[model samples]
Target: MASVFLLLVCVGTLLGSAGAQEAYDRLPSKFKLGVDMALEMRNSRAGVKRLLLYFKGLGQSDIQPGNDVTYIYHNFYMKATQCPKGTVDTSNCPFRNIKPEIDCAICYKTIAGKIQASPKPYINCIRKPALTEAMKRKRVNYCNEMGYSSGAPGGLADIGDTYF
Candidate 1:
């Protein structure tokens, strides 16, 4: 009976993970663009501290239509990393070992799909308390997959420098 129960638990875990992957795969590209824009906005405001953050995941999102523009609201997560603002290679940077933050923002894009730099999308991020042991353990699997990102897509353009 114990062995049977273990098998069922494993199977359930696999199914749950597969479902999550499928959902992510089906997410609209616009959702990803919103998340990317949110990340950029957050990094831009990371002033004197130079603290840089990486995308964690989206908690919630919604889109509203306007006359000739669309508002994409996003509530997402970002993990603080040891990498600073100018870090050229973030793939080697690990998390700061602290609790991640939840960022909320609303991005305005044109009907033609260009993000408006003017109305500067409203963005705010708040870091929670430190992570407990269990919370850290729960994120172990994400560590390996967290590699590859070397800061925002166009580099630190906020500082007036662009990488090729």
Candidate 2:
């Protein structure tokens, strides 16, 4: 639950997506043994303090008395993932059940390339689900543009593929 919460707060800040079409533009990558929360936050365009405050405010109520944090996180993840395809706002995302819908972009990030190592990095809002052959080709191109050699094996993925 802690891992999930931390991951959510940090990754959530990058949810302002522009779709995966241009992930090839930035094509950032990182390598490490495990999640380096601090380093990631430091590298974000959004100030780390801002994201911390934002997520902290959002997650405070998640830990309730006698209610396992793990359970809360699991439920959130499950319900959000099951949301209708193409949903931009997480109105039904269980993260919030109120009228004001939250952004689904929080969970939709695009990663283009075969991970050369652990702690794979991703481009912000550059990849989308390729529904056709052409889309898949775009993903391959994204990977190639990231400095991958011919047929070196790389592709596109989203935050959904990373987290939930």
Candidate 3:
């Protein structure tokens, strides 16, 4: 009975190791998938908004101007301008009409500085290379933890064959 139990333990260990190796093999492909997803997200308006919000909320107050203020200001300006003059009587104007008049100089300058200071969100506005790099690093670490080589023969394909 003891010998049977030992044999079972060895088999379980081997299976577990093989499963781990298989997982490692798939890491590159998973990394690529993550990168592709990020790229797709970056191309979308909602995705851009989410990323901007994330960066803005991460205590990167500098990015808040561009991500929030500038965007909101522009939208407001456009909406206000869309209404033809005299279309709505000013006597009943609900909100103060500061459009095209107030200048919003401080807000504009602040947003401009934010835009200039950190252009990563803009550059990543289309591709998100930084996110891709982060994903790559994560996959490398995961592969290492699984005792596998990310640069193994056939690269991602080898992992796909075994796992996916």
lDDT of all predictions: 0.46, 0.25, 0.26
What are the TM-scores, per candidate, against the unseen true structure? 0.46, 0.21, 0.20
List the candidates ranked by lDDT, beginning with the highest: 1, 3, 2
Total clashes for model 2: 4
Write model 1 residue lDDT over 7-121, tens digit each, in one string: 9976765564444344435656666666556666666664624444444454433333345444444445565555676666544444454545654433333345665664444
lDDT of 2 by residue, 1-164 (tens): 99999999656534422221122123223211111222233325342222110111111001122222110111011011223333444322222222222111111112231222322332222112313445434433454333233222222222122232
Clash pairs detected, candidate 1: none
Cα error of candidate 3 at position 38, Å: 20
Per-residue lDDT of 57 in model 1: 51
The list of candidate 3 runs beyond 4 A from truth reads 29-164
lDDT over C-alpha atoms for residue 143 of model 3 = 30
- What lDDT score goes with residue 116 in model 3? 21
Candidate 3 lDDT score at position 132:
48
* Lowest lDDT block of 10, candidate 2: 69-78
